[model samples]
Target: MTGRPGGAGTDIGLISLDEAGARAAARVAPVPGVLELPLVEADGRVLAEAVVARVDLPPFANSAVDGYAVRFADLRPGAETRLPVLGRTAAGDPVGTLGRGAWRIFTGAPVPDGADTVVMQEDVTLSGDEVILPSQSRLGANLRRAGEDVARGQEVLPAGRRLRPRDLGLLAALGLERVRVRHRPRVALFSTGDELTEPGRPLKPAAIYDANRAMLRALLARAGADVVDLGILRDEPTDLERHLREAAGACDLIVTSGGVSVGDADHVKAALSACGSLDLWRVAIKPGKPIAIGEAAGTPFIGLPGNPVAVFVGFVFVAWPLLARLAGATAEAPVVFPAKAGFHHRKKAGRREFLRVTLERRDDGAVIARKHPGEGAASLASLAQSDGLVVLAEELEQLEEGSTVPFLPYAGLLG
Candidate 1:
């Protein structure tokens, strides 16, 4: 191991939160393989190539409302002009040329060749076969021009962007059936601890059910990684080293929770050192402090804390960006909004802290972040019940009530 990572009192080689993120991102590169999938299967996949528009959006000018299509010159400036309905057109009907009278056009119908304006049907009264036109209808109103939304040959979606539902709709609108997307990064995941047992089984004395694997599995799926579950590992250095060696050859990245701290039971750092190399970083952040980032037999590895909340925070701040980069996704930080603090908190200097908080909109139209009462590192309920995290910077010694704080919502972090 490069350097030892400890829990408390030992602060030798502790890096900042930003530095930890940068080191993790620098350890892995994007997967080179690409695959072509139909538009229906492309959701949540990163684009390997930019999507160019094959044709102009709404290739033809269409009516924006159910109304009359007429030449702007036909309407009198200060008086109502009556025109006989010459023809009718609905959506998908071939467009026709506008004559002396107005053409009754429905919404989304192609505008007639000689018409420059459309008046809403509700704005004019119909008498016999003629429609009364209002005097003040503006020119080019209620019409969608060709290529208004997107032009042909334009890049609608850039490479490295994760495809969403709306992005799929845009691709379908451009008449594309298949899209080239980067191959999903395969991640080998596991948890280590002698006092852990799987759920659905009776727990022995001094043992707890394994929660990290299940939670991390779901989070990995949400982040677009194809997870290779190695299951729960016992705290044996030989077995751990063997598993890491096998996983390294098959997976693009290997992730484990627990067994990185400087304790008798922690053997991940030593096992990694035996097989390949290890960089044990003590990050200056609350909940998650000692994080192990290294390689196992040449494959990248990340060892997170065993505490559920710490694992969650560590994955979001440290591992998530590395996974995104490996999956060919562009870097996107979670958006944080300013909110008033409904409670007060005090912390030490030289460490960043994240408080689980729920937001409340006060009667005065101000958003307030109320911190969760459970402040333990392993409190899973705090993560479940709260909206997101209220970030307290290292320089902030005390957060007073009613002070402005930066709040990051969980909605912005997940898929």
Candidate 2:
């Protein structure tokens, strides 16, 4: 077990996942700036202000289907009725008002005055200008009301909303060509350990390729933060201290992978203290336990584990949310669905365990979670083979086959 230190501003002992999260959240704040950007450029950005709809969605009440527009009272239920068609109305065009007679209308065509209901063209018999509407019990069923989707002057998107593709389209519909969004927090990234080498380069002796940096870069980018990769640093204290100090001045946050754990070669904790206070939080989570939260010269720093899969899980559980908060976005936890366990396993209590799992449907058509065969913090294949994670809660100690458990798909957690 790694030992905790006092007098360095680091927390003592192993803390629960909730406790670690709360501490991290309390320490890190939203970056202090906003930017006005075009709609296209605002994709994946957090909205700094609520966006109100300038016009109602659809803009006007129109035909929901190609049919005849008439008064609901005019047609008797279960009886045939016939009336002369005044004219035809297509999408984006207006036809003359409907009298006591019927008027032909197409989908998206503005409903003329005096008409309240529409019957599909398929349901009606057409002969020249006369449209025969069969008896229909449903009245005013086909009319899509104006502002049904979104009303004018309504807050279409609240502040702190992370802009998605649909959000962009909605903003465009509101006639907003640009939006005020929070500036993406600039993150400085570095990797530690002499055993680590760049992926493309040849490894020397006991050195292994650095996978943490690349994974972190993608994760940070997907979270909508700008990343400045400082590459891999040797285990030397002087090298680590120099790079971290320089990064502190220019970056809003500093992220280091590998040297977070207690090792003689690890200088990240020392480096953070030299620049700013460092907190090594041993979170109660499987795969990733040692996560460090600190600051270097007013820049927030998050130290992640070196193991590839641990780095992935750590980011998903802690760093990801922290980064989102810094970007002024509301944290969206992964959507979890209850599923039956396909296998049985028991683990030590107290720690929240996340097992990579693939979902399957039984002959009865119920969803079952099949745990991945391999369990290793450094094994990326397990994450690749599995569709999502089976989250064993903090208090759970044993899992039996067919028992319901919460499963989170990769789509929800991964950026």
Candidate 3:
């Protein structure tokens, strides 16, 4: 990979992926705000404050079945006790007070005072407003206690938590009409290349349709970012500089692909340096070695590789976590699973490798990974057809078949 021209405060040295990520994360600050939004609009937003329970869930003890509430001491394992049915208590109906004889209750109805157990209607025989309790009745049977799901004053959702659909449902169940959440990070994305053409247009012999922009936009949206498509820029430094300036003023972060390489048409690196400080460039990784991290007019700019697969890998390893941090989201380590290598692979030391593979269930019910045929960074079909990527550490030289390796699933990342 080529290096960036030396400038004030620019680290042009080659660094490992971990070092590159750490440096990039340290350069940006989290966006500040605690906006109060309705629960309906809070889905996919990170919580700025911890949500504490205001009232006990199921505030009162209720019956979990449509049955009669009774005292456990009134019946034994073998003996039958007859109790007169007082008033029927359906859901939302008031059961004034329970008489010593009995009380009728339906599902979700509050258990009557002085009742300690519930017996399903099918377990007893009813005759003329009188029911015989089975001797096998147990105490607290079919009864849901107050605060079983949540307690008043308990923290239900912590800060930095990304709210999911089920999380919003839980908040609604708690009667929370509104919640405080971190502001979404505005991301402006663009592409740059003379040989690139937009989809749905006729492609010349030397030009190919742009795929990195769409792919990265989808990935950013999936990460809960407010994406602004800035379209494509030519191989001119002045044109790239204009877009960089606009993006810097309008967005919290700027991401672009296809202009950070060593070719003469690759003017994004120079444009960024001319606009602001280019902090780091060129990470030591396969398929994505030509990465760039810079700040243009105080806005963080990430220049990803031109290849489609490389752009995706770079986003997963670098941009995703940085965007989460900028959006005030809690960071989580990538999910990895142990898989046995189905083929022998060789790699150089001191550089992480992400090998694409398809996972299949073997006859013994074990997951066996099969490596894809093409390993080129521009092969989007291979990445789409594969299930996950196997991560090889920087130290190992050779990996034989049956060797245990860590694999990361693409489905998990998107989710």
Task: Please tell me which predicted candidate would have the highest TM-score against the true structure.
Answer: 1
Kindly list the per-residue Cα lDDT of model 3 for residues 147-183, writing each as its tens digit. Answer: 9999999999999999999999888888999999988
Runs of candidate 2 exceeding 4 Å displacement: 1-12
- Per-residue lDDT tens digits for candidate 1, residues 316-341, read 99999999999999978889899999
CA lDDT, every model vs. true structure: 0.91, 0.84, 0.87
lDDT head-to-head 1 vs 2, winner: 1
> What's model 3's lDDT at 357?
95
> Following a full C-alpha superposition, what root-mean-square deviation does model 3 have from the true structure?
5.1
The TM-score measured for candidate 1 stands at 0.96
Give one clash count per candidate, in the order shown.
0, 0, 0
Local error of candidate 1 at 259, Å?
Answer: 0.8
Task: Give lDDT for model 2.
Answer: 0.84
Clashing pairs in 1: none
lDDT of 3: 0.87
Give the poorly placed runs of model 3, Cα more than 4 Å off: 1-13, 77-82, 125-128
Better of 1 and 3 by TM-score: 1
Candidate 2 RMSD to the real structure: 4.4
Per residue, candidate 2 scores C-alpha lDDT tens digits across 8-73 of 333346788877777777777898888899998888999999998889987878889988888888
Residue 51, candidate 2: Cα error in Å is: 0.8
Candidate structures ordered by TM-score, highest first? 1, 2, 3
